[model samples]
Target: MTTAPKVALVTGATQGLGLALVEGLARRLAPDDTVYLTGRDAGRVAEAVRAVPGGGARVRGELLDVADPEAAALLAGRLEERHGGVDIVFNNAVMRVGPDDDPREIIDGYAEVNNFGTTRVLRAFGPLLRDGGRLIVVASSLGTLHHLAPVLHDRFDGLASLDEVDEQTAAWRDAVKDGTARSGAWPGFVNIPSKIAQVAAVRALAERRRERDAARGVLLAAVCPGMLNTPTSALWWDVGDAATPAQGAVPLLDLALGPVDPDHYGQLVRHGKVVPWRP
Candidate 1:
């Protein structure tokens, strides 16, 4: 008997890790399988879709700026209309405004793109995921609370659960709203706090995925691909032995195809190690 082709939707596929993921999945999936390669630029999306390993009609490109809630919903609607449902949803797009940008703007942008964007994608495609379908969130070790102590100067290592992070975010949000949020602290930018908030949001999504049984038994996982020498990281001073985009795609592919297990669900996997995350 022939198996049904799995449908995958990858955002930010114009280049870097997202592009590599589209290519990897294109090579692994059957001809009938559909892969939606998306990016902020239409031309870039088209180019990335065309650059996939195989020259087949199976791969298609779409213009998607995940930060735009309406655009995300529209993409989902299009997918639903065309394929009825999708088997995999990859939330791979992220925004890192340069160091020179206004700190508040940077934080707001990251919060919109990294945190709300993932939530929008999940909300849009949740109904489209097939039973036992997979949802992969391409995160970074920087977002891992466990790694925060060692990586982020031991500032807030005590944040272990989504609730704790939520409380922290709420406090910051309140501070900002009340005109008390600091603007002169170390890493004195809203971006850092936003990153922490994004991680917390990811954890909350995982928890919700685990609790909901009607959503095709979705297995949500956040993956940290390590520091990749992609164009996105060029602005950073020290990327630290950045790996090729192909290398960064490994964990994503593994998470996409791995067996469904509760232990793996909502977990953050990086460097072949399953970093702890809320269930």
Candidate 2:
């Protein structure tokens, strides 16, 4: 008997790791399977689809801004109507700011796009994930709980729901804006809190929807692709001999399409291994 066609969705696929994910999926999936690559810019989305390895009719492009819930919902609806449901979903959209940028703006920007935006995408696309599907959130290594103070560890480690995660992230942002972040024992770096929130969201979501996910065998994981030689990495640190975007995408591709490990769900994984959340 012939296997059914699979459907995949990858956010922020116009460039870098996201782009590589689209390419990897395109090459790995059967030709009849559909791989949807999304980006905010229509032009870039079209270009990325065209640039995928062995580009074919199976590769499709769509315009999506993860920060926009309406757009995500609409896209999910289209996928449901067209393909019945999605087999794989990769949340790869992100935003970063330089040190010189305003702390409040940086915090809010990251929170909106990287933290809450991740949750929004999950909420919209999660229900559409077919049985035995995978949902991978592209987080950063800096998003670990150990990066924060011990006092803050339980707050994140104990996240049981998305609402709680939101409250924690909001509290961190408020502390920063009110000049109490340092005293509150939260990390001073603007990106750390948001990244922490992103990972925490994944953990919380898994906990909140454990029963439903278990029945469907849907896997949820937060992944750190590690530092890559992308433009975003170059702007923040010296990436001498860093893994290329394609190389960094290896683990991500594996997680997206490889064997499902029940232990990996709701945890942060790197290089095909689970990374400790706490120090």
lDDT of 1: 0.70
Per-model TM-score, in order, reads 0.81, 0.93
lDDT of each candidate versus the true structure: 0.70, 0.84
lDDT of 2 by residue, 151-247 (tens): 7787778778888888888788777777788666777777887888888889888887777887778899999998899766787789988999889
> What lDDT score is found at residue 119 in candidate 1?
67
Native-to-model Cα distance after best TM-score fit, residue 246 in candidate 2, in Å: 0.6
The global Cα lDDT (0 to 1) of model 2 is 0.84
**Model 2 spans > 4 angstroms off:** 55-57
After aligning candidate 1 to the native by TM-score, how far in Å is the CA of 267 from where it should be?
1.9
Residue pairs with colliding backbones in model 2 are none
Return the top candidate by lDDT. Answer: 2
